[model samples]
Target: MLDRYGFEPAREAPDRVRLRNCPFHPLAAQAPDLVCGMNHAFLTGYLQGLRAPAVQAILAPSPGECCVELQDATEDGEGAAD
Candidate 1:
């Protein structure tokens, strides 16, 4: 499922999903802020469009991994800003 969106999803915890690779590596390398922000927005909308409103896309950059992560919005009252 995630593969189709260029993400190799990994579960770090019950409510957290990490991405192993970035499809827009070249562009991200050139402009991490711009690219990551766009990715976050896109993922957020994507999740909502899929009717998965509980899942939120966040920009959580990590070394050797994609900058975006998907987490359950039910945790700690944390979720994407509406």
Candidate 2:
């Protein structure tokens, strides 16, 4: 689904995956909070629907970087941020 959103993998690590290219560029530039939030929700739902309880979507937006990052979920079923 990242491809469908025009995001391509930029970096990969044991715990995280960074993606680049925003399909919603212009709109994201206009409202980062909204766009990023939606992106996060979409990814979260996607992962949940796939029954991937060990993975999660994180909102770690960066310029020229993916608005979301797929990361290993912590033991509490939450991402590292918690």
Clashing pairs in 1: none
The number of the candidate with the highest TM-score is: 1
**In order, what lDDT does every prediction score?**
0.84, 0.79
Model 2 residue 41 CA deviation (Å) reads 0.5
Candidate 2 lDDT over residue span 1-82, tens digit each = 6776688865578878787876788898899888888888888898888988778888887897668988788934654444
Q: Residue 24 in model 1: shift from native, Å? A: 0.4
Candidate 1 structure quality by residue, lDDT tens digits, 24-66:
8888899999988888888878898898878888889997678
Best by lDDT: 1
| Model 2 whole-model lDDT (C-alpha atoms) | 0.79
Q: Give the local distance difference test score of model 1.
A: 0.84
| Candidate 2 pairs with clashing backbones | none
Q: In model 2, how large is the Cα lDDT of residue 41?
A: 89
